[model samples]
Target: MRVVILCGGESSERDVSLASGSSVARALLERGHDVVLVDPAAAVPVLAGPLRPGDVVDRIAVGKEPPSSSGRERLRSRMHAALTGGPVLELLRGAELVFLALHGGWGEDGHVQALLEMAGVRFTGAGSAACAAAWHKGRAQAVLGAAGVPVAERVLWRPAADEVPQGVKRLVAAGPVVAKPVADGSSVSVHRVDSLPQLAQLAAEVRSGEVEMLVEPFLPGREFTVAVIGDEVLPVVEIELTTPVFDYAAKYQPGAVSEVCPARIPAEFAGRMQELARRAHQALGFGSAAYSRTDFRCDPSGEPMCLETNALPGLTAGSLVPRAAAGAGWTYPDLIQRLVDLSTR
Candidate 1:
């Protein structure tokens, strides 16, 4: 199969996406498949050959901020290349399957998916509408809640000059709340706040036009994530974090959080998590998604609450989906091959 692994969009998760694309591309190459790696943020550059594993991994460092000026200029040039019939879009045109390794912003928010669908390109992951619905936490919660899925209480807040919404007040009254961008991944800019004043302060600092704040009551119990590939649900992975929330640093920084695959929970509870993960994926109309990851938290009463669904979950070595796949007895290469095979179906 000739595959173009598209990654490194202009989202906050650019570095992570690049890492994922590299891993998937390397694995695909090992499986004897032709792979073209494209970083859309770089405007889909022309590559002479399959990316070297070492070079791909070393391309980007993990951090929260945007890329430096030189990096930004390079990306700008790349984007211009795509717009001007550059090698990126040209390569995509002749590919058998466009493997989407993109995360956050335009890549994961259904924008790129919509374009792909219009171009009649077969790609991995959910459809455009599903991506849009799943990209925003607030929207995902509403959709999932209506489908009878258990979700944590949440309040949405945009930039407002007046007063905090009543929903925000209600959420804060319950307990500490987790605040984050509705559409971003890798826990970027996520915060756990205890007071309304802190939320106000955080809200005041927001200047981005695209990000809307989502505040949900923080679940103090265990956190778990389950990955669904094709029709199978991988093992549940539990996250033990030293920090209050799985912020940007804790997520990408080594030794910041301890992860246990096939989380140390009762068999029945693990079954329940997997079931919810599947149901959540289906409820969001991601039945055709090549692969996806659903996150959940157990409330104080041990009831699982769906947090958010990811249409394009990370495929990096340290990503939760791979950990869960390992627990389910599938190698990373096996998982990548399966996903590629499923993309056509």
Candidate 2:
């Protein structure tokens, strides 16, 4: 199969996406599948190349910070031109399957998925509607809560139009709360607030820039993530954070945190988390065989509360989905092949 792995979009997670694409390309090549890596954000769209063993580990390293937004507007203009009607579109149209190894931008937020849908191209992961639903934290939580899946209480704030919600103010006054962009990934700009002043500062910054944000009570328990593929929930992976918050640096930087697959937890607790993850994925309208990863943090009583569902979870070598899949007895190459099979089915 000829697969075009899309990655390195004009998003904060571009480095992570590139790493994932590089790893996926190598794995697909190992399985004798023709793989072309295309970064739609690139001026020229084509990044095809040969892969040697350890190329991903040796060459593609995510920086401590995302690429600067210095020339992003110009790059976005170029990306838009390249993706709409050019060699990039032709490449996508020519692929047997476009493995969406993208994260946290137009690529993962349903815009690209919609484009592919309209172009009649088959790609991995959730459909456009599902991606849109799951990409926004507040929207995803609403859908999950409505579906009877346990989720933390969240208040949506549109800083541009409305002042901070009284509910958010109350939550902050009571205890620690988390504030983050309603629609973003890689834990970018996610902050833990312990006081009203801190919350107010964050709201001000958000008001000056983005439109929407979500405020929820901070869960102070172990963090675990479950990956679901084709209705099968892989084993849970526990994230042991070395830092106070699992910020972007903690996520992609090697040795910044530890991830333990088949997390050391009671069987019943793990099973319940798996069920909640599956429920969250389906609640967002993901296809029966689609893949997703649902993150969770336990409440004070140890009950798992869904954070958000990732329609296009990171596929980096150290990403949670791949780690959980390893716990389920699948090699990295096997997991990539499984996704391809599921998407094409």
Candidate 3:
């Protein structure tokens, strides 16, 4: 099988996506599959040919610091060129399947998926519509809530005309609030605050129109994530963070958090979470998705609240989805193979 691993775009999660694509490509190559690595953010010259082990491994990043503003601009420019560049499109059309090892941004938000669909190219993970619905936090919660899934109360707002809306201010002023970019992942710009002033500052920054933000009641409890492949739910994984919030640092930095697979919780509790995760996936129209990972926060009362779902979850070794799959007795390569089969079918 010839697989084209599409990854690394202009999103804040670009570094993570590159690491994930690199890992997936390496695994596929080890299994004797022909793997071509394409980092959309890189220049066109790098978009062709089978990836060398050293090229992919050397790009693995451990830091969560997002690319600088100028860095982001350059990436966005290169990405735009790559998307329209003749060579990249030709490569996509030639692959047996395009393994979407992308996270966040246009890659995970349906843009790239839609393009692939239009070009009649098969890709792993959820469909374009499912990705669009899952990428937006506000929309995802609405769908989950309508399905009777527990979720924290949240409001989406862009500083209306450069002024923070009254409702948004009240929500932040009332008590502890979790402020985050509505469509981003890896916990970028995710903040927990109790002061109205602090929230006001965040709102002002988000008012730039480049980013839409969401404010939700800070759910203080244990965090857990479940990975769903086909109709089967993998084991639950618990996340313990040393920081006040599981920001980008805690996500990518070494030893920043502790992850326990098959989470040491009661079987009944784990079962409930797994069921809810599956429900969330289906409710969001991901029933036909190759795989997905849904996050949750257990309230102090021990009831689970759906956080969000990822249509294309991270494939890096330290990522939650891989850990959950491992607990289900599937090696990383086995998981990759399963996804490839599903996409090509």
The model with the greatest lDDT is: 2
The list of candidate 3 runs beyond 4 A from truth reads 45-48, 51-59, 71-74, 160-162
Sort order, TM-score high to low: 2, 3, 1
Write candidate 3's Cα lDDT for 1-345 as tens digits: 888899888888888888998789878877778878898788653553575434444448756586654577788777767766488888888888889988888888998888888888889999899999999999999999999889988877775466666767777777788888889898888989788778767666666556777888777789999999988899999998787677888888878899999899999999999999989989988865468899998766878899899988888888888889899999998988888877666
Overall lDDT per candidate, in order of appearance: 0.80, 0.85, 0.83
For model 3, how big is the CA root-mean-square deviation?
2.1
Q: Would you estimate the TM-scores of all the predictions?
A: 0.91, 0.94, 0.93
Tens digits of lDDT, candidate 2, 1-345: 888888888887888999999888988877778777888888767787433333442348788887766666776776677668877898889989999998987877898889899889999988899999998888789889999999988898877765667898889887998888888889988889999888777767767665588889998888999999987899999999877678898998889999998999999999999999888888899987589999998888988898899988888888889999999999999999999989878
The positional error of residue 107 in candidate 1, measured at the CA in angstroms, is: 1.0
lDDT for 22 (candidate 3): 79
Candidate 3 shows a clash count of: 0
Candidate 3: deviation at residue 218, Å? Answer: 0.6
Identify the superior model by lDDT, candidate 2 or candidate 3.
Answer: 2
